[model samples]
Target: MAQPMAELADLLTRLGTWTTLYIDGPDGSPAPERDARRTSIRDRMLRAGTPEPDVEVALELLTDDGPPAPSSQTILVRDGTVRSSWTSSTPGRGSGRRS
Candidate 1:
């Protein structure tokens, strides 16, 4: 059986994908200004013939901000799991210049 955290991850993944489908404009078109990319693990999984539930579980584990740090090699263990890594910028630490 999977853990609660894993379950939450799966839900979030599905929600993320469904959210993307409801966005403005048709698929393959660029999102309008001020809009953000809403693609999710579910979208990728469907494209690669993977099960949505499995993809969700893997995304949950890979995104957990626990020790060891997240990385691309963090095997998702799903059929179409696309392993990726990202570095976010810290807020409030700008170049100290006026706009």
Candidate 2:
């Protein structure tokens, strides 16, 4: 908790646009459905001006096996670098920054 907040505060001090993604659990979805969700997220991020490198990194971190245990994950990227990421037990909507 405190560690994540501290990392976020450190990230905020940098001078670059931030791209954040909040992903919900897989919720027992099939593999194909989860793949579709990944594709959708990738497309949306690319359309929203996120760099390809950052998007790839985000996707890699977000991926997991076996339905993912009803958790939410947040990823923060800046200048093609992933500065912070954390997972929570609570569910989160699949959301991303516009730019």
Question: Which candidate number would show the highest lDDT if scored against the true structure?
Answer: 2
Cα lDDT listed for each candidate: 0.37, 0.77
What tens-digit string does per-residue lDDT give for candidate 1 at 11-90?
45752232111111223334442123324545665697656665565544432232221112122343334333232222
Which 10-residue window of candidate 1 scores lowest in summed lDDT? 17-26
Give me the overall lDDT of model 1: 0.37
lDDT of 2 by residue, 25-96 (tens): 557778898888999999999999889988998898875642475677778877777778777775444444
**TM-scores for the candidates:** 0.29, 0.77
TM-score of 2: 0.77
* lDDT of model 1, residue 88: 28
Query: Which residue pairs overlap in candidate 2's backbone?
Result: none
